[model samples]
Target: MSIEFYEEYIESNKAIIYKICRAYTHSKLEFDDYFQEVCLQLWKSKEAYNHQSKLSTWVYRVTLNTCLSIIKSEKREVDTVEINESFDHHSDLEDTEAQERLNTLYMGIRQLKKADRAIIVLYLEDKSYQEIAEIIGISMSNVGVKINRIKQQLKDSIVWKSLI
Candidate 1:
């Protein structure tokens, strides 16, 4: 693909790329690095894309695979910092509350096994079971089952954290 097309493609899919990167990395530095790596991988594999799947679906697969590989190679445990500490103290009550909820959810997501994290993030992005199965290489029925189980796991984690 031409450089222009690649740039446009990345821009169009930036949101999903950032979301996947954030799901994998806790710190901003790590997020930036992971995002770069995902983009690089996408560019390198551009010629290999055979149009068997939608461009978005191909991007999802590449992003998830790149993140999973990076985490596996590094073998570093995610840091367990207080989620609120990363937020601004001056935000109003409503904004703070919303940020806290989002942070809590992300914290819960980070605690999951990598594969489960990928599944949940895609599900949260409103991907259909068929699309998720296509991206994750699982059966459609299996995606539904895994999604239900992952939802319960996240709920339990959030509730358990609140009790602490």
Candidate 2:
């Protein structure tokens, strides 16, 4: 890679890789291993990185694949943090609420099948349905249909659990 391109990747992708690592592992050791694995995967896929998809989309795809390939993750410790362009810290109370929501979100995501989780993560991160469909190799209408079905399934499962 050119110096400029390498620097660009460093500037934009460092934190993304870290977040993916934390999302996929619970311990510092596992985080280090997975972080390296993700970086290696990203490096290997550099030639295949098409500009047609957003950079973050590509990163998420690689990260998910790496996580799925890992054999020993029984517990996941990551939160669904929303990144805003304005960089608002929000209040500590809001952070607590966000963390709670994130826990719920992760639990809900864990309830999904591999395919469903991909769509949900992308949707939660505010990707356009068209972009998400393209990234996941599905049709646009299928994306909406899958999301609706997953939402219903989640609702039903939650309601059923309360009865127990």
Candidate 3:
């Protein structure tokens, strides 16, 4: 596809890219790095898409594979980066607290196995279990079970936030 067409796709899909990037990122740089890797992989794998599945399914499959490769190759553990006050642009002070909670939530999500993490991301993005299963090549029941477990795990992790 031409650059213009790809650019349009990127714009339309920015939310998916950004949220998935956040789910896997350890730092701001890692966000950009993984996103670029996903874009590259998408372009490279474009020829491999068989058209049997939807375009969104193909993108999710490619993105998840790229993220899993990064996770395994880096062997990186879950760690939140130090908050850079300079990057703080919240309009209301109350919103900063919400941001912290969201950051922690994502960090907890990041601790999950890659498969679990993918399910959680798709779940939080309000994707149906059928869609998630189709994209990840899993049974719908598996996706349903995993999302419930991931939600419980996340709730369990929130007990110690006052200490942080």
Candidate 4:
């Protein structure tokens, strides 16, 4: 792909990349690094995209693979970081509550195994089972099974946290 096409592709999929990076990284610095690395990897592998799957699918696969590899190389356990440490004091109560819920969910997600984390993130992003299977290289039925199990785990985690 030409530079122009690649730039357009990145623009279109930037949110997906950002969400994946945030799901994998603990700090803004790590998120920035992973985002850059994912973009670079996409550019380097541009020619290898054989049009066999949707561009979004390819992007998800690449971003997830890149993040997983980075975590593996670092050999450090993934830890949860407060997504936005400086809360906006002027925000509405409802908005603050929503943000807190999201942060709690993300913290739970971060504690999951790398593969489960990827699956749940994709599911949350509204990717269909087929799309998730394509990105994750799992059978569609397996996607359903994993998602159900992951949901239960997250639910259990949240419930356990509430009891503490």
TM-score of 3: 0.81
Distance from true position, residue 57, model 1, in Å? 0.5
What tens-digit string does per-residue lDDT give for candidate 4 at 1-164? 47696676688888788778877876667777998899889999888898898888888989999998898898877654333432222223467678777767777787788899999999999999998998898999999999999999999988887797
Candidate scoring better on TM-score of 1 and 4: 1
Which stretches of model 1 miss by more than 4 angstroms? 1-3, 77-94
lDDT of 2: 0.63
Measured against the true structure, the TM-scores of the candidates, in listed sequence, are 0.86, 0.64, 0.81, 0.85
Choose 3 or 4, whichever is better by TM-score.
4
How far out, in Å, is residue 89 in model 2?
Answer: 16
Whole-model lDDT values for every prediction: 0.82, 0.63, 0.73, 0.81
Q: Cα RMSDs of all predictions?
A: 3.8, 7.3, 3.8, 3.9
Candidate 2, residue 136: the lDDT equals: 83
CA lDDT, candidate 3, residue 19 = 71
- Per-residue lDDT of 94 in model 1: 72
